[model samples]
Target chain A: MTLEIVSPGLSTTIQDLGRPGYFHLGIPEGGAMDRLSLRAANLLVGNPEDAACLEAVFMGPEIRFGADMVVAVAGATMPMTLDGAAVDGWTSFEVKKGQTLKFGFLTEGARLYIAVAGGIDTPPDLGSRATYPIGALGGIEGRAVAAGDVLPVGQGTGKAGRTVAPELRRMPGRPAELRVLPGLYWHRITEAAQESFFADEWTVAAEADRMGYRFKGGRPLEFVEREQPFGAGADPSNIVDGCYSYGSIQVPGGTEPIVLHRDAVSGGGYFTLGAVISADMDLIGQLQPNTPVRFVRVDMEEALAARRDQVAMLDKIRGALA
Target chain B: MAEIQAPVPGTFYHRPAPDQDPYKAAGDAVAAGETIGLVEVMKTFIEVKAEAAGTFKGYVADNESPVTAGAVLAEIDA
Candidate 1:
């Protein structure tokens, strides 16, 4: 079956769980900003958790199904309509042959997922179908979906009408408390700056996209006074180019702090203060501009616990749906 | 009466920018797709447009107030 894109929303691209082993080769594991929702959507349609789905940003897309199919939408509280009538998201629903699906303005969250029961049949790059637009890797030729694009859909095995619990869905609001695991070059920053990093309410800047989120409204951080080592740039914020962990928060010129996300550069010269916990990285993506964020320091144990909780939550969703 | 609802949720601004005048006020005329305001989310200002042509009514949402998706933004008398 084919899904015809009528109006491609902002940055609508295909994504999945991403490739894990290729990071050492400088390939970013560019995938869904919200894995919980992506996996949930996939499970709703009886697709594998890593099944490729559409990642719609800011707005959603208008697609006309060429054949009957089941689909689910999760993440972001946008108005979903089938043939111009409203339909609830986060549930598996059926679409008749030649019927169109459209989305209203995004009310909450930054990215939303649209998962067809059979998964999106896109050419995989680096062992993944997730789109890394910067490097031109994976998903619809490594770019966002454009109008007039005809996407091939796989035959679905799941039945329609599978709905997730209301409480299970993520609701967007202010002041997300993201957990951070302080490490890497955390000691390079003065203690005062580290304190401020956790203490102040930082606003996500407009420059934020899939690559990273730049935080404003905080005290500009300062590096400890020291002579620059050879091969390290002259700027105090610069270090010898080192590998970056996913969700690494770095400061450039000691100005606004930026948290790298999926599709982020693998390594850079900027000194990273710490990495945000993997479980909370999706929350960073959901935050609206001007949304308040406070970084909470967590131990590795706490971080792992949080990840376990998320996994268990997903399992719970599968149980509920089953 | 035609009520215009917010398509997306964020902080609603009556003007395009802080220093600019609002697109419409009470008693102003508006056409469909006319930009009436902007919703600031993650620093992206998405234009809130007039859904249909009508005589503009004052906004139900306060200026610079946080709003959710599907919240009624303003009304219009066609």
Candidate 2:
């Protein structure tokens, strides 16, 4: 079976859980921004949680299914329609052969997932079907799907009518609060600047995408008056090129703060103030441009506890779906 | 009556560029799918298109002002 692209939506790409253990080679673990939604879409269609699915931003693709299949969409709040008839999201539904899927203007959030029963059968690059467009790896031709492109699908059976509970579905908060753990470079800036970072409300900028999110409207961070270290640039925000963990919050030139996401570069010259906890990283993806946000500081213990809660929540979802 | 809504949220631009003329002006004939303006979201500019052939009424949103999804940017007499 195959899926034919009618009109590829704005920035639609195939993504799975992503390929880990490759960031050391400068390849980010590129995958779905809202992973929970991806997983929910997959499970609702009887596919594995890591199955490859379409991740569309702002809009959704117009697709004509080549064969009968089951599908589900999750994440964001765009209304889905099949063959001009309305269909519910976060619930699995059947699509007859030759039926087309489309979406209306997004009502909320920034990205959404469309999971087919057997998952996309594209050849895996680096053992992953996830697309890393920057590195030209994985997905169909390592790029976003274009008009007239046919995507092969693996064989599998899925039962329709499965739905993820509303309470179980993850959504970003109003003025989302991202918990951060201050890093080793925290001392580079004045304590007052650090306090301002958490106190001042920052808004997501127009520069947000899969790689990272840029936040503005916060107090400009002031670096301590110290001589630049060897190999570091005169800009106080510049460091001696250190490794960047996923979710690292790098404020270049102490200006707008940027939170690196799944597709982040492994290392950079900018000093990182800290990272958004893994538990809260998914929320970053759903944040819309100009959305107000606040940085909440957390200790290692709190971060771990948050992560554990996230895992437990996933377990609850699996149980509910099963 | 026809409305051209912003497909996504961002800063609405009435002109193609800061110094250029607006994509459409009041009373101008707008063809279906004709570019009306642009919405700059995530550092990318997406053209807002008129959905029906008509005479352009005027922009509803101000130039370079923030707009939300589905907010009407321009109106047209279909």
Candidate 3:
């Protein structure tokens, strides 16, 4: 079976759980921004939780199915339709041959996940179907979907009408709260700045995408006076190039703070005050431009607990869908 | 009256750039699919187009203001 793209959305790409263990080689763990949503969509379509799905941002592609297939959409709040008939999201539905799927304007959230029963059958690079466009690795030709691109689908036995309950969904707040663990170059900034970072409400900037999310409208960070270290630039926010973990919050020029995402560079020169906890990383993917956010401080123990809670939430989803 | 709604959430712009004149002003004739404004979302600027030919009634939303999807950006007299 295959899916033919009639029109590519704003930024549609195939993504799975992502390929890990390549960060040391300067390659990030590029994958779906909303990992939970991807997994949910996959399970609804009876595919492996990590099976490749289409991740569309802001808008969704117009796709024509070449054969009958079970499909599900998760993440974001974009209304979808099948052959001009309105379809409910977070639920699986069957599409017949020649049937087309399209989407309406996104009313909430930034990304949406569309999962097929057999998954997108693209050849995986480094054991992943996730697209890393910056590195030109993975997905179909390592890029976003284009018109007339026919994507292969693996064999599957998924059924239709499987719905993910409302309470089971992870809904982001109006002004989302991201729990951060201060580390790395935290000492480089003054105490006043550190306090202000958590105290001030920051607005998501227009530059948010798969690579990173930039937040503006926060108070400018003031750096502590210190002799410039070798290899580090004169900017107070500059540091000797260091590894950037997923969710690393880097503030360049101490003006706007950017949270590195799945496709972000492995290392950079900007100073990272801390990282948004892993549990909250997926929430960042759903935030829209101008969305206000606050950085809530958390300790290592709290971070670990939050991670366990995330795992539990996944377990609940699996059990409900099983 | 025909309404021009924002397709995505972002900062809406009346001009192509900060220094340029707006794409349309009050009482300007607008053609269907004509670019009336821009909505900058995820660093991508999408042209807000008029859905039907009409007389421009001016922008309802302020320039560079943050807007939500479905928020009326401008109106036109059909």
Candidate 4:
């Protein structure tokens, strides 16, 4: 079976958990920024959590299914319809051949996840179907899906389940309190700045993307001259080009904070003052432009526990699917 | 003298292929924007392009060495 892309949205690409352990090769771990939503959609369709899904940013494309298939939509709550009939978000539904799927305005969040049973069939590079747009690797031709692009769907046993409950659907929109952990350079900032980081509210700046989401917050942080030195024996500069892991909080020029996402560069020169706990990255992905956000510090042990809890929850959902 | 640092943190490679000559050696005339080395991260090899045009001086870090962000990989005589 196959799906024909009628209208590729702002940015639509195939993604999975991501390609890991190759940072030393200069490849960023490109994948779904909001992995939780992706997993949820996959589970709804009885697919593996890491199955390739369509990640639509800002808007989504119109697609025509080639055969009867089960599909689920998650992540951003965009207005979507199948054959001009309104469909529920975050639930699995069977679509027959020749039915057209159309996505409308984004009601909540910045991106959407569309998972189909059997997953999106594309050549795996470095053991991942996720697309790295900057380097042009993975996914279909290692690029964003475009109009007229025909995506192949792998063969499945044709066994599928029912839809998810409406209440179980992810709450659309960004959350207020954002959890973070101290990073390598957390001590570089003065205690006053650190306090302000948690005290003052920040807004998602216009310069937000998969690479990093810049935030406009309180007064710019000022660091000692020696703390901003470069080269050997010098403190790493607060500005450089590189993709950081999801949740990395950068304090460039000791001013605004930028939260790095999945498609972030492998490394950079910026001083990472903090990192949003991995469990909280899904909330970061849902942040809307100009949305106010506050950072809440948490200990490493707490972060670890939260991560475990998240993994367990995903496992429970998967077990239910079986 | 200015140094050419790794654009991104990764393993610094002197040559593209093993058993191949280094892209540039000490005292070689190199121009700006010339790729002097490469950094491999996540199975992706990114070429490190020289920002300043000058004579290639020496490498600060050895081949196949793990380097972090801003780590100077090579020096050039400007």
Candidate 5:
């Protein structure tokens, strides 16, 4: 019926598929960073695919449930325990009233998802319960869950013990590669810099979060010389402040590249070199600081194919559980 | 002999900020849950807290150096 937070983790918030159709109003979609994982967690607990779940980053919370409930954890590998007993992730399990859940150190990935049967019963704002802390929209009062805050839970419809197996999903790569679709503002950057964009190995910067991930460890890219246009900033990387697609890469000051995510700003003036393919956003969401990354260019056909493959993977998970 | 590990990987900071004194020095008594350092990633600096009461051992990872998950950051004489 309710969950009591004994300790709030680093950054735990409620998220779902997010609210689209509002980007024109300067509101980000602001869903779970890794939607696939959110879906997987919901599936394990028999909740609807978009049922809002808790997105815990780095550290996870210590939670006590007020009633018996089914639960599942997916995405990052933060060791979890149910009343001191080890709890396996990617698998569903049940807990009795007054039982507590704790998370240990993270051995892999950046964000972790915890899904309860039914869902986190919070009122929606603009059709979503996903939190965008920057604007104080959605989630519990539009912020991360705090200690002693009681969260309501809906009724559970699924059983426990089933697992989500997406081939354990991209945890072992030393320098993960993100497949990219280039040419958003490709003509704006010099040919040499564009080459390096795909060839050079970039490191995830410490400034990364749900809004965007900035990468370092590469030379500042040079943009092609052009007369400054009206309303565009004086910087060469500036544009006319255009729409930013989710996963779009924008370089400001041409110093570092940022890939927007679920909580992406609707429009920006910076020049975008490319976008991480839709299928590859999950991999980007898992990047940790100092993690090496390389961008590989792909055509639109390949991008669509990759997305289809991901959908097939979800169907695969559903079949295995069934 | 127990050592404090980095819960998550990032650049390990020995002090709260660049100008502040180091949170702990070797031989200092450390209390449980006391923050001794921070691991900064993606603009978020997560405090590294002492897990048990012990005599602090000097940092293992150099200040501002990149650390991997589970990598020893400092030692504690329990």
Candidate 6:
């Protein structure tokens, strides 16, 4: 089966779980920014959680299915209509051949995930079908989906289709707190600065994008020295250059914190103050400009617990679909 | 000889404040770790420090313009 992209929205691309174990080479593990929602959509249609799906940002594309298939949409409650009738998210529905699917402006969050049964049949790069626009790798030509792009659908393995119960759909609202882990450079900032980062409410800056989300609030962070002290690698004296990883909170010149995301670069000179715990990165994606955000610190133990909880929830959903 | 660059992606500002004079003009002597420019990402303003003491040469990117990581902001004669 093939799906035709009529309107590809602001930024839409094929994404899977992500590409790991390549961070040392300055390559980011690009994947769905909101793994929770992606997995929900996939599971709703009886597909594996890691199956490649369309990651739509801001809005979604208009598409026409070439063959009958079970599909699910999740995350960022955008106004979506299938054949001019409203369709609920987190539930699987069969689309007839030639039926049109269209989406409208974002209602709550920044991105949405649309999963089709059997997954999208795209060539995988580095063992993943995720699209990393920067450095151009993976997905459909390593870029965002554009008008006229025809996405091939993989053949299903004959698994019985399943749908999500209404009670299982994600609640419509914004999260108030963002869980975080102190990063490598966390010690560089003063105690007061750390306190402010967690206590004061900050707003998402307009400068946000897939690369990173800049936050505006609290007092500027101050450092003991202007120059970064060397720990290892390039001479603490040599300047380092490259893109940064997703969810990394960077502090440059002792100032406001900027959280990097999926499309972010591999490395850079700015000190990464902290990282939004992996499980909480999706919470960052849903934040809109001017939305209040508070960073709540969590220890490694807590982070692992949160991850386990997330994994267990997804596995349970998948089992229900089986 | 050495060159100075913006350490991160942001909008380059020539002076520290809106009403202040430019930090250093072309051919001005500069010291290592001196603040030559500022890159404003979000509402945070970060001073870009020169890595090595040198004579200020010229800017590769214009002031008040957006730049990506590693984009050379200015050249210095070390």
Rank candidates by TM-score, best first. Answer: 2, 3, 5, 1, 4, 6
Q: Report the lDDT tens digits of candidate 4 across residue range A48-147.
A: 8899999986567899999889888888777789999989887778899999999766656767899998999899999999999888888888899998
Q: Candidate 1 lDDT, tens digit per residue, A43-122?
A: 99999889999998777889999899998999987888899888888888888989999888776787889999889998
- The collision pairs in model 2 are A206-B42
DockQ of each: 0.32, 0.82, 0.74, 0.01, 0.73, 0.05
For candidate 6 chain B, the 10 contiguous residues with the lowest summed lDDT are B1-10
- Native-to-model Cα distance after best TM-score fit, residue A131 in candidate 4, in Å: 0.7
Which stretches in model 2 have alpha-carbon errors above 4 Å?
none
lDDT of 1 at A301: 99
Off by over 4 Å in 1: A170-173, B1-49, B53-78
Best candidate, lDDT: 3
For candidate 4, the per-residue lDDT at B23 reads 94
Global lDDT of model 4:
0.78
Which one is best on DockQ? 2
* TM-score against truth, every candidate: 0.87, 0.98, 0.97, 0.75, 0.96, 0.74
How large an RMSD does model 4 have? Answer: 15.8
Q: DockQ: which is higher, 2 or 5? A: 2
- Evaluate model 1: give its TM-score: 0.87
- Order of quality (lDDT): 3, 2, 5, 1, 4, 6
lDDT of 4 by residue, B24-74 (tens): 988999888999999764345778888889999988999987665457899
Steric clash count of candidate 1: 7
TM value for model 3: 0.97
Clash counts for all predictions: 7, 1, 0, 16, 5, 6
Provide the lDDT at A244 for model 3.
92
How would you order the candidates by DockQ, starting with the best?
Answer: 2, 3, 5, 1, 6, 4
TM-score of B chain for each model?
0.93, 0.97, 0.98, 0.95, 0.96, 0.92
Expressed as tens digits, the lDDT of each residue in A188-300 for candidate 6 is 67788788778877767658776788887667875544364454223221234534566878866555678888767778777677788877787776665556677889999
